[model samples]
Target: MNNPEEKEITFVMPFGPQHPASGHFNAMITCAGENVVDLKAYPGYLHRGFEKLMEYRTHVQNTMLSDRVCILDPFSNEMAYVHAAEISSGVEAPERAKYIRAIMAELGRILSHLTWIGIMSSALGLESGAKIAWGDREKIIRLNEVITGGRLYPCYFMPGGVRDDITGDMAGEISRVLDTLEDKGKLYDDFVFFNTTFTTRTNGIGVINAEDAVALGATGPTLRATGMGSDVRKDEPYDAYPCVDLEIVTMEKGDAYSRSMVRRGEIAASISLIRQLLQKMPAGDFKVKWPMTKKVPPGETYFCCEAARGELCFHMVSDGTDKPYRVKIRGPSFSLALAVFPYLSRGVQIADIPAIYWSLDPCPADMDR
Candidate 1:
C-alpha cells in the first residue's frame, strides 16, 4: 500500500526539559533504529545571571550568591570567590581557618558524591540504591547544619577565613560522621559498584580517551578517568592543601565505570583529608575581622579550587569599591554537560543514554550559571 514516490525520514527525539534522566536539561537525539547517530546538548534551562548579579552586590554579600552557583557543592564556589577576593584585597586567612576551609571543602566533596550516587542509581533504575545513598547523605547534611549552620549552602567561608571556629563538639561530630561514612563505603561497593547489573551497564560504555577528553574540555573525574592524574589540589595547592598529604585518583579505561571509580576513590581520599585536617588543625582565630563596608583594592585576580565536579575558578576585578566590577565563574559542568555529553552520546544505544549522562555528573545549574 506504499506509494512508489514516497520518501522516508529519520526520527529525531527530544530527550528532556522535564525528563528524570535529563535532570532539567535537554538533548536533541537522532536515532537510527535505537542507536544514536547524533546528539546536541541544550543547556540554560536554569539561568540566574550570577556573574552580572555579583557585580551589583558587595564582595561579602556575593558569598551568599556564590552558594547558589552549584547547590551540590556550594562550598567550592564560596572558596573560589573568597579566594579571588582575598587575593585582590591582599588578605590571608589564619592557619586554623585554612585548615577549616580544607575540611569543609572535603566534606562538600563527599556530600556531592553522595548526591550523585543516589541520583545516578535512580537513573539506572536502582531505586533501592538511590534510597540508601540519599538516606546516608542526610547524615552529612545534619552534620553540616550543626557545624556551619546551613544544611546545603554553608555560606561559612569568607574572603579571609571561615565564619566561625570548629569547636570541640563540632570536631567530635565531624569525626563521628566520617567514621560512619567510611563504614558505609563497603556497602556502596557491594550495592552499586560491585553489583553485576551496574557493571554490565557501565563497564565499557561511553568511552573517552585522555587526549579526547582534554580536547573536549573535560575536567574532574571525566578527565581523570582517562589515566590523567591532573588535579587542581595536587598541581596548585591552595588553602591548607599544601600542608596536607593528598593524592589524585585516576583510572585507565576512561569509560563510565572508570569515571565512577575515580569518584569512588575520591570519596575515600576526602575522608582521609578530613582526618588529617582534624589532627593537624591549629588553634587560632577563625577569621579576620572586617567591616561590612569593606572595599577591595582595584586589582584583577584569579583563584581556583578542586570542586566536586572539577576546577572551579573565579576571575574577579575590583574598582576600589565594596562591589566587584566584574566577576566570571568557570564551572566545569558547562563543558562536561554541553560539550562532552554530546560527544559521548554518538553511537550509544538509547538504553545507555542515562548511564552515560549521569556518569559525567553534569549539574545543569552549574552549566547555566
Candidate 2:
C-alpha cells in the first residue's frame, strides 16, 4: 500500500567505527537514495598518544615504540627513527649493517603487501584472491621470525645498525625463501592479478588524477599510481638504498588496480634488492655499541622513508637529553583518507563506497598517529 502524500527522505549513513575490511576508521557518507553525494572521514582511536609517549622513552627504547605506531610496516618506522637518531648522534652504520637493514626492510614490505592484498581482495568480494594472498603471507612471516627474534614486530633495528647480524647459512636460507617467493609470484599473477573480476572491479575505479594527488600530498604508491615517480629511496637515498639499484614502479591509471599493481611490482623488485644485498653484503660488525641511556645531541632532524603504504616520516627534536624533547609522526594515510571525499563524489554508487575507500588503503593507526 503506497501513500500518495508520503515522501522519501535521504540521509547520511555511517560506514564504520568498526569495519572488518579495514581497521578502526569511520566514514559518514551522505547518499541521495543509492548514489553517494558526500563522504567525511572520521579516523582516530589508534593514536594512543604515540608521539607524546615517545618523549618519555630513551633513545633506544623508542624504537620499540615506533613499531606500535604502524604495526603493519614496522621496519619503515624503525628505519626512519634510527636514521634520525643516527643523524643527531653523528654515527654511521657499517656497510654490512646497512645492507642487512635494507634487506630486512624490503622483506618487511613484502609481508605487509601480502596482507594488504588479502584485505583488498576480501573487500571486493574476491575470496579466492584473498585466500591465496593470506596463504602466501605465512611463508614470508616464517622467514621473518627465523631472522628476527619476534614474529611480528621484530625490534631488530638499533640506532647504529641492526640489533644482530646475519651470518653463516642464514643468507642461504633467505635466498631459498626468495626462490620460493618467485615461484609463488607466478601463481598470483595467474590467479589474482590477471583475474577478470579483479580487473573489472579495480580498473578505472576510484580514479585520482596526478595533479589532485600531488596537491593532496599523497605519497608512496598512492602518488606513484598516478604516474608520479617520486620515491624517498630513489630520490633521497638513505641506509643501503644508495648502494642498491632500484627501478621505480608506476601506473598511469590512478585507480585501485594501478595502486595494487604498483605494490605487486615492488614485491618483485624487493626480491631482487634482497638478492643484490646478500651478494654485495660486506663482512663487518653488525652494530656500533651505544648504550640505551645515552642522550642524543641537541638537534632536530627529519627522516622519511617509503613504506609499504606510503611515505612515513619522523620529525625529532632532541635537546641533548636521554629522553626526546618532541617527536611528530607523519603518516601517509592522513592525506589519503581526507581525499576520500573528492573521489566519492556523486557518480559512485553506495555499494561501491567500500571498494573505493579500500583503494586508498588508509591505515587508521597511521592516520591517527
Candidate 3:
C-alpha cells in the first residue's frame, strides 16, 4: 500500500508460451499508463536446431527434419530443400513427377491456410469461425493422408521427384474436397467478415504502408495486403508453377483485416490452381532413377517456393559428400517475428495482441529452427 500522495509506476508484463492467445511463442511487453511501451519476442521455446542437426545426417535423412521447421507447411520446406538438392546434383525430376509435386504442394497450401484461419478465429474468440475453418481443414488433412499415407508429416517429396504417384481415386477425392471447401468458404465470409465484433477488432489495426512493407522484407499475404502484386510463384516460377497459369491477389490496406481478406482470397485461388493442375495432369513415370547412395557435386544452390506463409527459400552447400556441408533455411516467419514487436507494443491493448499476432501468422517453429 502507498500513500494517497504517492504515484504509481508501471512495469513490464510477459505474455507467453502458456498464454491462451499468444500462439506458440512468448512475448515480453512493457507498459506505461495502459499503453505498451516496448515489446520483445522470445522464440526458441520450440526450436529443434534443425540446421545443425542436418549437417550430421545424410541428404535423405535431412528431409525428415525439414518438415519440422514449418509443421503447418511441411511440403513447402520439403519441396524447397529437395529442389535445391536436385539442382546441386544436376538432376531433373520427370515431367509427371513435377506435376505431382505441384498438386501436393497446392494441397498442403490449402491445409495450411485452413489451419491458419482456424487458429486466427480461435484467437479472436470466434468459436463458430474456428469450428468451420477446422472442419474444412480436416478434409484437406484427410486428402493428404490419402495421397501420402500420413496427415501431418507426409514426407512425400524426394530428391528425384515425389515419393509416389497419386491414384485416380485420390485425384478425384482432392477435387471433391476442393468443392466442399469452396462452399464452406462462403459461409466463412458471412460468419467471420460480416460479424460486427470481428470488423471492429481487426479493421484498420496494425497497418503497414506499402513502402514500409517492402523495406521490412514482408512477403506473402502481408506484402500482398499492401497492394504489392509480388508472388514468388509468378516471379520465380519453380516446378509446376511455370506450367500453370496463376493470378496474384493483393489488397489496398496492410491492416489485419486486409491480411485476413488476402488469405481468404488466396484460398480460392489455390483451389482453382489445384483444379487446373489435376485437370491438365499428364500420365507418366512419377520417379526418376538415381543411385541408392550418391554424392552431391561440390557446389552451392539456392531455391525458393511460394509457401502458404510466404516465400520459403533454402541455400545448400555440398562439399562433394553424401551429406551437405551446410544448409540454411530462410523461413518467412522470421520476418513476421521481427516486425511484430514494434507493431504490437505500445499503442495496442492486450486483446489486440492475439489479433495482431495472428494477422502476421507467426510460426515460431519456423522462426527458431
Candidate 4:
C-alpha cells in the first residue's frame, strides 16, 4: 500500500478472444479501479486475408470467397464483389435482376441487424431479447434458402446478375415473413428497448457527437446516431436504391441507445424498401448468363454498396484474364473496431464497455479481412 497522496495504480486487463460478451475480438483495457482509461483492439483471430485470396481465385470463385468476409452478411459481400467484377467486364445487370438484388440485399440487412440484436442483447444479459430476435432472424435465413438454395452462404449473386430469379410464390413467402417480423418488432420495443434497465445502462453512455464521429470515420447507424444522416445508399445510389424511396433514419443522441434506435428504425425502412422493390419488379431475364471461366477486360474498377454495417467497397484490377491482378476490400468495421471503439471507451466504466462496444456493431470477420 502507498500513501493516499500518491497516484492511483492502473491495471491492464485482456477482455476478449474467449469472453462470451467480447464477440471473439480482444481488447486490452487499461483501467484505474472500475474506470477505463484507455483500450486498444486486438483483431485477427478470424483473419483469412480475403483480399489476397481473391487475387488467386477466379472471378467466379471469388464470389464464394467473399462470403467468408462476413458470414453474418454474406449477401452484401457477394454483391459488392460481383459489382466490381461486372464493372471491370463492362457487363450490366438486367433491370429485373437489379430489383431482385435490391430485394435480397434489404432482406439481408434485416437478417444481419436481427443477429446484431441477438448478440448485443445477450451481451447485456437480456436472454429473452436474444431469443426473440434470433427466432425472427431464422425466418429471413429460410427465405434465403428458398430463393438461393443455400442458407448462410447463398452465393447467389454473380457478376452480371443473380444465379436465379425470384418466383411468384417466393415473393408471397417473403411478404409473409416480412409481416411476421413487423408484428414482432413491438415485442423488441417492450422487452428490450423500453426496459428501464436497458435505458439506464445505455442512455448518455459512450457519447460521440456528429463532428467527432465523421472525423473518426464512423458510418452507417453509428454515424447516423449522431444526426449526420450520411449513408452510402443516399450519398451514392446503387442497384435498385436509385429507383426506390428510402428514408435515412437518424437520431440526435450519439450514445448506445441512439445507435440501437437508428438500427431499429432502419429495420422498418428496409422492410418498406423490399415491399416497394417487389412491387416494381419487371418481367425479363434475370441474368446475362456468362461462363464461370469468363475473362474480364484489362481495367480497374472500384465498386461499393451499403452493407448492413456501413459502406462495403471492393477494388478490382484485371489484366484481361479470369483471375484478378489485385483486389482490395474496405470494410466499415475496421474503423469502428480499431479506431472508434478505443476513442469512445476512455473514461467509461468497465461494465459499460460491452454497451459501447456492441453499439457500433463491429464484426470481427469484417475487421480482420
The RMSD (Cα, Å) of candidate 2 is 1.9
Tens digits of per-residue lDDT for model 2 on 4-80?
Answer: 89666578988878768458988787877887777777777676988999999997999998888777788888999
| Residue 60 accuracy (lDDT) in model 4 | 87
Clash totals in order: 0, 0, 1, 0
lDDT digits (tens) for residues 1-369 of candidate 1: 879896554679888888586777999999887889999988878899999999999988999999999999988999999899899989899999999999999999999999999988898888878998999889999988998999998999987899988986899999899999999888999899888888899999999999999998899999999999989999989999998889789999999999999999999999999999999999989999766669888989888898999989999989999999999999999999999999999999988999999999989889998
Off by over 4 Å in 2: 1-8, 340-346
Candidate whose lDDT is highest: 1
**Cα displacement (Å) at residue 37, model 3:** 1.0
Q: What's the residue-level lDDT of 241 in candidate 1? A: 96
Error of 2 at 129 (Å): 1.4
Better by lDDT, candidate 4 or 2 = 4
Clashing pairs in 2: none
Candidate 3, residue 143: how far the Cα is off, in Å: 0.9
lDDT values of the candidates? 0.91, 0.84, 0.84, 0.91
Full ranking by lDDT? 1, 4, 2, 3
Predicted candidate 3 versus true structure: per-residue lDDT over 193-236, tens digit per residue:
76777888899888888888777778889889999998999998
Q: How do the residues 120-218 of candidate 4 rate in per-residue lDDT, one tens digit apiece?
A: 888788889899999999999999999999999999998889999898699999999999989988899988888776788899999999899888888
User: Which 10-residue window of candidate 2 scores lowest in summed lDDT?
Assistant: 338-347
| Model 1 bad stretches (over 4 Å) | 1-9
